[model samples]
Target: MTFTLGPKATSAGYKLAAFDQIGSTNAEAMVRARDGESGPTWFATTEQTAGRGRRQRAWVAPRGNLASSILEVMDVSPAVAATLGFAAGLSLESALQKLSIEANMRRAGTEPLQFALKWPNDVLAERQKLAGILLEAEAVAGNRLAVVVGIGTNVVAAPEGTPTPATSLAALGVQVGAEELFKALAEAWVEFRGIWDNGRGFGEIRKLWLERAFGVGERVAIQTGTTKVEGTFDTIDDTGCLIVRTADGRRMPITAGEVYFGTAASVGAA
Candidate 1:
């Protein structure tokens, strides 16, 4: 009924603040961060009335979904802190594998489900999005900034109408709960933090991420700025940029874009 730090998290000095409902956990974390709250803490809620994701997409969490934000005062710059997206993605994937589905019953006629990482912070199960991660940074005192990592996972039910195909653990015949997922995520964060090592170990992070990445060699379309580019989903660069190989054999390194796997009509949310 309450959020408490696991053994690893507690040893790492992490804390959790649980709420029954909130406008947005990230908003609350940012507000406190702006007020000089440099916390290695987490702001979690049972429900969110005004949850938002990347590009300000409205996130709908119907009670059983997991909606939480982890705020950390980093010594790195805003640009460096942006790499938390990758860390968060890897962490979420680990958490899901740790406690994703129930084996007693199967949904979608699948026995054991799997979770994979999509570029730019989305986690997928059998190619459908099961969770997403959003990273934001707010300048605090001096050169340091407070990085807020927001995670939204579909638990009991997936969104009805979505740009991309959506899925939930329950839909996959997994009976995992939000609290269980959150706790696994908190511990997973601690486990991956050493590999991150404040970005010094990014090379390893990038390598591990690529191993669990989804849509590695699939045809994909990306909408960048006002231009749209279609190509094969090549490997992500060492710096975490999505590399797409066009028809002309030219490799394009995209830093920021909305990527959709498959056809033009398949251009969904990122």
Candidate 2:
């Protein structure tokens, strides 16, 4: 099915650029931004040939999977722009939950899937990584900053033996297609983005995110380079840093790290 923006997104003046296959939707969006494409535009595909996730890790989406990115140019600080990723996470989670419910309705006695937003940028289903989000920003002329939020979901395929175990919508028995998910995502984005209000409404977003957050108040270990920090997942601060309450009663804010949970937290396993 051809990709198109939902009614809300279209009415909000958002545009879409759908692709059958692409090296990376994030890369395409950034390239467009460099070419003076000052947009609230979406670049999406079901087959991503060469995608990259956080920390430069490869995030290739095979055929039948979904890889998408949205670009926005705004006059905000980089710190403020970073919080936008939280909104992206919330948008996708909302979309997934809606579709999963609809899918479950068509079947008999099927348990509805549980979805949660992971710390920083991931969506978890049954505690397995179902989607990842990456945000990139660059300063442009006229003192405006161009930011791209990339979201990749396992619609029908997931790689084996990842650092964190991965799962797909098909594997979870949701029976959703990339086209349908993208349409829902576009609509959800419109709602959450309006609520986010370009970072001004992040307090509300933060509260909503924590309500659907995974691993909160649970043991978590974060590895930043050679250093490792272990503590309970306290909360995310105003700027979206992962707040870990250490054993010594210090709330340490982690800006970036590879996270591990439960028993894996002790070993700092990949």
Candidate 3:
């Protein structure tokens, strides 16, 4: 029940710290960054006492769920560092696939699930949220950026009473543990981060992301700041900005926002 860093992480020069319980792995990682811990590091925990999501929304990851954060020092600007969200999402997807969770679902007589990646950093199975990603960044000396990518996934139990429908691998009859998934995730992160090539390979990343995109060409509402715009989910541009077309035929490139996939995706990171 302990979290350990495998060769995939250590060989890649990534350090890891684990806790039985913590206020927030992302917060701890950021604290390390501020304390002169220039790292490609991971902070993981079994339970989160004060977790949070984008826009400061409360994020609850109970024991048996996978809650982890990565602190990466990058040579790029803050804007470019945000692109790590895309890599994180893809890494989660790849990890799940490597674990063969879907095959287990099929053995349980459930039809094959159509997994999709939502805008920003959410993963969906049958259009329901299976995982979420949150990215935060800060600047250091020499214009270097320290970005933290927080990933939370339901494994043994899914939270009830949420904005949108939530699901876990166990709900779909896949037997998995947080520690096992974390191992796969560590390796997967190495692969995806290499593919990202420090923001230079975004062209390839964007293409792969589009291949697994969810709700493309579908009507949705994206809230940025005080403005809530309804539009069709277009595609992520080369720079990782989401492209949306409004009712007025105006195209908007949203740098970041809360996307509502109509009524179904009202998910509060639930």
Per-residue alpha-carbon lDDT of model 3 for 121-230, expressed as tens digits? 88887777888898999987667888999999988778787655789987866687898889889989998899998899888888888999988898877777777777
lDDT tens digits, residues 100-212, model 1? 44453444555566778998889999989998888899888876889999999998878877767899988877787788888889999987777887788778888989999
TM-scores for all predictions: 0.93, 0.98, 0.91
Q: Can you tell me which runs of candidate 1 are displaced by over 4 Å? A: 101-110, 264-270
Off by over 4 Å in 3: 101-111, 262-270
Q: Report lDDT per candidate.
A: 0.83, 0.94, 0.84
For model 1, what is the C-alpha lDDT against the true structure?
Answer: 0.83
* CA shift of 81, model 1, Å: 1.2
**Per-residue lDDT of model 2, residues 138-187, tens digit only:** 99889999999999999998889898899999999999899999999999
Top-lDDT structure, candidate number: 2
Most TM-score-accurate candidate: 2
Q: What is the lDDT for 35 in model 1? A: 88
Off by over 4 Å in 2: none
